[model samples]
Each structure stands twice: as structure tokens, then as C-alpha cells.
Target: MRGSTNRNTRRVRGVLGAAIVVCAVTTALPGAASADPAGVARTAGAEVGTGVGVERVSVAPDGTQSDGGSTGGAITTDGRRIVFSSSATNIAPGNAAGSERVYLRDEPSGQLKSVGSYPIASPVISGDGEYAAYWVLLFRDTKVKLAQWTAGSSIGLNCDALNCSQPSLSGDGRYVANVATIGRPSTSQRIDVWDWHANTKQELAWFDHTAPSRPSISGDGRFVAYQNGRTKDVFLWDRDHGSTSGPIEGAAKEATLVQISEDGSKLVYLSGTDTYVHDVSTGTAHLVPNVKGLAIDPTGNHLLYAPNDTAGPSLKLRDLTAGTDEIVSNQPASAGVDAVSAGGRDVVFQSTADDIVPGDTNGKSDVFVRRFS
Candidate 1:
């Protein structure tokens, strides 16, 4: 559903902008045209759930230390590196009291490095694994800015004076989409997409009294999926013509989380207690064989959701092709699964499962990685 322009909390900001440059190699995913169906399954292997596991990568600390607490984070398509926000001291800009700064973690190296020491959130990586983007709140300002994280630099884009949030980057890192709110509390909220390479911005469509927010873009940078109003109505933004498509099928006004496939041909949303998948090309909505969370794999082949019949929201994976479903974890009490990154034989998610890790369960959530055996 669209987000309201009304401020849920008072406006507070700390830092403005800081740019850092470094060096790193750029990696790209294989093109969809060359993707092999059977090869993909074989690569994922038969033991899809055995070696699969989750890691509590981030947490909130007792004091205001760098890397102190976890705010939010996202993983690369290849599942190699993770980018998140933290208040840890080793980072920079120190602790801004209640504000958060961006941090990057190299899974292979187990190194947690501070990327940006600004109040940044909603970090998303591109499909090519070459770039990252996030929404940064300019200290003491109501206007939110979009920053790009590449090779080793954080550059701010020209978003004019509009207030924006929830930034989503495309696989190629050429396009970025975000929710832009115009006017005030009673103002209008619409989806604004920018072509970074072209240096152009366009407003797709308006949500009437509802504000379109939390946009997720496809790998090809052709489609954008976002929620509208309280009725989990997910709409697809067509970048070619600057228009929106459908509310999808089986989607109720109560649908909460929404995600789109990498190809931009499928839409997934949470309807009531179940997760529904819709074929955007045919406008058909079906219950994904046996999965329940609001998150969908990048390829759109698997979906993750919280099961209602279970005690805590367990991580359920649905195989779209086989029409089969399986629970990844046996944990009873779990929070909602936030995201799923699947592409290179590995699938990872951000969840809160107490049983997965011992003692460290302080109610705060962490990132988990699972490889399909």
C-alpha cells in the first residue's frame, strides 16, 4: 500500500554528507538469456535445506559504539558481501545518538568496514554486484538524498528538493527508483525513478490519497513493484511509458510486504496470512505452492514468508516450478522474513530466529545465509 506523507515521528537528523573513495573489483551476473533451468537446479543441488543456514550478522549494542546496533541491511546478488547500517565506533562520524550510519561487511574476509557515516538506510545492491544505493537523510533537513556506492566512492545524486525514501537499484546499476513525497502531511506520495546514466528523473504515477512507497526494481531495470494504501495493493511501474500496471491477484487491501521478480514479469505480495504470487504478464495470482513469507527470491523462483499455523513466523521456501514447498528452519518463534537474494546457487535472507543462534538472541534481528545443497 502507499505510504502516508504524514510524519509518523518528529523529524530528526544529524550529519549532512561525506564522500570517500577507495578501489575494488567489479563483478557482474550472467545474462538472463543464457540462464539454464536444469543447470540452475543442479547447481542449487538436491540438499537445498541441509547446508542452508542463517547468520546473525548485526545487532544492537548496550552503548553508542561504532557497530553498536543494527538498523537495516542488504546483500549482494552473489551473497558475498553485506551492506548495512550500524552505530559502531570503528566506523566513523561516531555515534549520532539515535541516528544510524552505513557499514559494509565482506563475508569471505569477515571484515566489517564503515562505508558511510551518515544517517543512511534501505541499502540495496544492484544485480551486477558492481554498485549499491541507499537513502540518506541530510542532517537536520527534511529532504532525503539518494547516494550511490561504487568501486569505493559515495556520490549524491541530484534529486532537487523533493523528499524521498526507500531506494531500489536495478541489476545493471543504471536505474534507481524511490518513493517521493510532495507537499506536506496531506501531500501526495508518488514513485520517482532516476536513470543515473542519463541523469534524468521522471514521476511514474500517483496513488490518489494513497502514497506509493517501498519500491523494488527488476534486474533489467524495466519494472518497479511497490505497495499502495493499506490494502497491500502492489503496482508495477513501467519505466518505458511512466505508467503503473495492476494491484496483482489475490492481493487484499491488507497486504503488507511486496516484492517483484528480477525479470519484472512476476509480482509477489502477502495476502492475509498467505503469500500470493502473480504473473504480471497474464495478471494471474496463485498461492505459491507452499511458501508463506512476504519476500521473494531475485529470480522469482522461490518465495519466503511467515506461516500462520506455526508458532513463530518460520522461513518457508516455495519452489515455483515444482509446485512444492519446504520449511528451511524448524524454529517455532520467528519474526517476518525481510528479504531473499538468490542467483548464484545461494539464497540468503534477513530474519529473527532465536533457536538458530544461542544466547545472542536479544530480540534484535540478524542476517542469515543458506546455500542450496
Candidate 2:
């Protein structure tokens, strides 16, 4: 079901020019191999999802989906371990104690597991598939949790006395950044970073206004980027320097931050439906122009954007480093992209297009993944 090709070697190099392999350190696969000008290996890559490097992911291994729909796909860099939110009661057996909220799939083994038995959202997984983070609305307040993807044991980083939401994780799952709402007469939002290793939590900053924006933490937990509730602006907090540089967004008209790179060097945000990118090191930001894409590679050097400028109806990987774009998917994704694998090689997204894959006659929103090399 999977195959590889050396098509577009130059464009592929542009996408993988960086030093971040992101996908489980480039495990073995069948295909010819070579080196880029930078000397990075260009292997024809092996089977993913199915044998084709692209396949429907929101279903049973046998492609059963009469149960329910799935959304919010979060993944490890290799696309081997994908965790997502779903309402399907039958994606896997028993659903990890009857949980229809979140599920994890081991693509190589064709195994799946449900997260819990309650309502869950915004599921996120570590780059190495070591942990997963998410929020649950058990009652009036939403609680944030970090769970070991293997053991399923978790610790609640719910801020103790406040309602927390929008949980984001560092690639290693050692750091979790979430928004907590507290205060009396008027509620204010504070972004908190939790260190799973040290078992300590620190408040990055607070806003006078309350909002729904999530905070993104870097892979090492050294940096965090968020949207200020009061001014509709963006801010970056450096834990190493204990400094906060804010309002980094230029002319932001209610800009909302979407994701930050694993290194905190790049950030993606939406300003009234238009996608924008901010280079953290240079303190500069710009609208992507013509298309909207939210997923960023680990190095913050690439993005999975939709409505390819030349391809017409497709998703493209925009190389921030080379200032070029490569259409990754021949079919358009209905809900844009969910995440990009390391080096921007694998792309998973939500699509209602039946033609995206053969036998996708479900005609409903389903998750699909495609690999580009």
C-alpha cells in the first residue's frame, strides 16, 4: 500500500534543508537515498498511514467509519503516533474505558487507543510520542492534564484554583503551557507554564481581559508565545531570560495565535481569517498572502498551507527558509491542515473530499494524512 519516489528532489530539499529530522530520527524505509547540497539524506521514504504515504486516518484499520467523525489531529513528527478528538464510539475496542473524546493510533502497528470517558478537546502529542496533553470539561471549569502516552497515567496541571483551558505542550511533553482564568469582580487570564519534570508551575504573564487564546511552549520550554487578552496583541516570554517581549504582532486587528515552533523561533497567528507568520528572532511578522496555513515544522522553517496559489485546490508546504512552496496534497483539505511532520514531509488534515483517497465515499469530515518527499 506504500511506495516512494524521488520526484522534485530540488523542492524536497528546500523543504528539508534544515537540520531537524523531527520524525523519530528518520527510521529505516525502502527506497533510493542521496544527499542534499547541505548533505542531509534524501531517502525515498517508506509506507505511512497505508503503503502510499497517504491514507484516511479517522477510521478502523479496515476503514470502518459508520460510527462517528474525528477531528483535531495532533501528531508525533513521524506520523506514527497520531492523537485526535473524535465522537466515534467504535474507532477502537472499548475506547479506553468508553472514551469518545480522544484516541491515539499507532500507524505502523495498526493499533488504536481511546483517551478517556469524558469530554476532551485540543489534543496534543509530543514529538517523540512520549506524552499527550489535553483539556477536559468535567464540570463548570476545564482542567488541563498531561498524560504519558504509554502508561496512560496523568497529572492534572489545572492551576489548582482556576479554570484552565487551551493546553499546549513542548515536543518532549516536559513543558505544558495553558491559560488560567481567575480573579474576582472581573476575571483575568494568566498564562502558566508547568514543568512536568520539576513538578513546578510558573506564571508567565497575565492579561487584564479574559480570552480563549492558547499559549504555545517551545520544545525545551524555554519560550512561550501567546496573544494578549487586553490588547489583542501577541507576546513572547523567555523563561531562560525571565523576560517578556510583547505586542510583537504588527497592526493586529484582533489577532489570535495558532501555533509556535518547537524552538520558539517562529509563530503563526490569524488576523481576521488571514494567516500571518512572525519570526521571533527578528521581531517581524507578515501575512502569508493569498492563503491560510497554521501548522509549522519543528524548526519553524515550514508551514502546511491550503489553497495553493498555483495548484488551485490543494495544500502546500511553504518553505519559510527558501521562500518557495510545494503543493503536498493534490486534493483540498476541508479544515486546512492539522499538523506537519518533521521536515514537513508528512501532512495530516481534515477533509470532506471523497477523492482525497480511494473509498472515501463517507462524504463526511474525516482525517487524512499525506507524505511528501
Candidate 3:
């Protein structure tokens, strides 16, 4: 999702010396969700995404970090690669001394890497975890930059004539989408899609009279979703067909664009206190029950979310087809859920619950991952 603030399954040595074995037990909570069946299997929780692979994911282990932490949003999919914007210099090597930089944690190797020396924010990493797209502050202006982290290089996606932000990338890292302000006086904002590997960019949508905000892209870059100017309606762009469609019936005017399914048939949005999945072809909407912070899998078979009740929030994995809901986290996540893998097999969230992992005594919000087979 674009508006939220924003982990991995690799076994890396020299990290979290002791690993907690998560169970594959299914716990049933009846009446918790709509169309839910009984006894849905829920995966036990394991702590991951702590940057340093520690029991608790508070600032870096260097003890110089603070509780304020980084921004909340989709930093990555699959929970294998996570990138967060932070000001902590010790979080990664060669971090810009005083600027906020984007950091990536390669869970398989247990390494913390810095993307660049510029100030960055709201980074989104591809499903493969090889690339990251984020907004970087250069000089007095901010532009969207795409980094091929594996290659140790980055290039500005948006030109100097435009100020860009709110970037979204496909699972394979081939397509990068962003919103940028173009033209004089910077009154107009346009949505653009860049073929990272091809080094080509195209404007997907440009409303000379209105500005679109918050873009969500599908795994293969087939579909793109965003708000329709200043209206409550939402729109989806089909890159393959070069066609665009509507306020997507049933979407509340105040709904925030969330995720677009890989096939471009399902659109998810949040309106008021509820989240809805609209079938673009049928123009029908399904309300996800008792959960917020929703992320739908590319297949649309599973949906991941956090308990809507903020006072005692927890992570939930729902099987849309069988109508079953399973609690991913054994304990309440005081800081709420963060991101889910594109396959819905792994979920990353933050919690104040001490029992989520063994020896979690950091006494601060820590990140955890729950995995399912």
C-alpha cells in the first residue's frame, strides 16, 4: 500500500544466534471475519526484519538509534528484502553522515546495506529484493531514484523539470511507477511508469486539470491503481492494453488506493473504517472483515491484514476462497502490521508483545515475521 509506513526467511549465521522455531499450527477464531470457515491453519510467528536479525528490531545494535524509527509503508514484498529510511548513521556502512538514507537488510546473508548517500524516504523494494525505488532529496528538490543495489549504483528516474514521490515497483523490478509534478508553477502532477531494465519511461496518466496521488502497481506491471484527482473515486490503468477505467464502482469517494491484483481484475482500497476488494470486471466489492492494513496476494487467493482494533492490534491472514481467517501473530502487535509477501506466505509486522519471540527484552517495538507453507 502507498500511504502506510512500512522482512525475510533466510538462515544467516552471525545473526540472532538463537532462532525460535515457529509452529505450523492452525488456530480458529470463529465469527472474526465474513464468510470465514472454521479451524483455519495459522502459521506460528518468528521474529525477522530487525535490520540486524536480532531478537528485537529496535534501532541498530549500535545503541545510538532512537525509538522514533523510520516511516511506515510497503518497503518490500516477500519479507526477504526490507528497505527503511532512517537517520541512524550506524545502521549501515557509508551512510550519509547527517542525511536520512534508505537501508536494506538482506536476511539471507544478514547484511545491512545502504542504498546511497542522499536523503531518501518511502522506499519500495522488488520481490526479488535486488532493486529499490525511493524518493531522494537532491539539492533543494526531491526526485525519485531507482537503485540497482546489487550493482552498487542508482539513477534518477524523474528529470529536473519534475519533482517526484510515492513510487511503486513490480515484483520483478522491471516496472517502476511514480507521481511527479511537471510543468510550470508545479500545479500539475502526472503518473509515470519506467521500464527499469529497458531504461525507458512513459507517462501513464496526466490530467492537465487535476493531480493524481498514491499509485499501486501489480507484480508484473500489468495494472496500476491511483486516486482520481481530488475525488473519492479510484482508477486503474492497464499498461498492456493501454486502457484506463473508472471511479471503480462501490469505492467510497474517500477511499485510499491500496493494491491492484496481478491480473488487473481485483482492486483493493480503504474507505472510512473498512477495506474493500473490488472486482473490476464484475464491478462487485467484497468487504474484508475485522482487519485493516490490507494487502492482497497477486493471485487474489489470500489477503493479509492487521486487526482493526488499534487498542489490541494483531496480524491476520485470510483465505478469501475458503472464507477462513487465521491469526498470524500469537500476540498483539502494538505497533500494527507492516507488509506482506506477494505470495501471502510471509508477513512482517511490529509489536510490543514480549512473547512474540523468545528473549525479546528490548522493551521497544520490534519487527516479526510469520510464515506459512
Top candidate on TM-score is 2
Task: Report the lDDT tens digits of candidate 3 across residue range 90-146.
Answer: 455444464666666654444555665454555677767777777766665667766
The residue-by-residue lDDT of candidate 2 on 44-141, one tens digit each, is 33333543345667775344552566677776776678777776655655444434566667777655665443545657888777777777775667
lDDT winner between candidates 1 and 2: 2
On lDDT, the leading prediction is: 2
Q: By the lDDT metric, which is better: model 2 or model 3?
A: 2
What local distance difference test score does each model get?
0.54, 0.64, 0.57
List per-candidate RMSD values in Å. Answer: 9.2, 12.4, 12.0
Backbone clashes in each candidate structure, one number apiece?
26, 5, 10
Question: What is the TM-score (0 to 1) of candidate 2?
Answer: 0.78
lDDT of 2 at 301: 78
TM-score computed on alpha carbons, candidate 3: 0.72
Provide TM-scores for the models.
0.72, 0.78, 0.72
Order the candidates by TM-score, highest first: 2, 3, 1
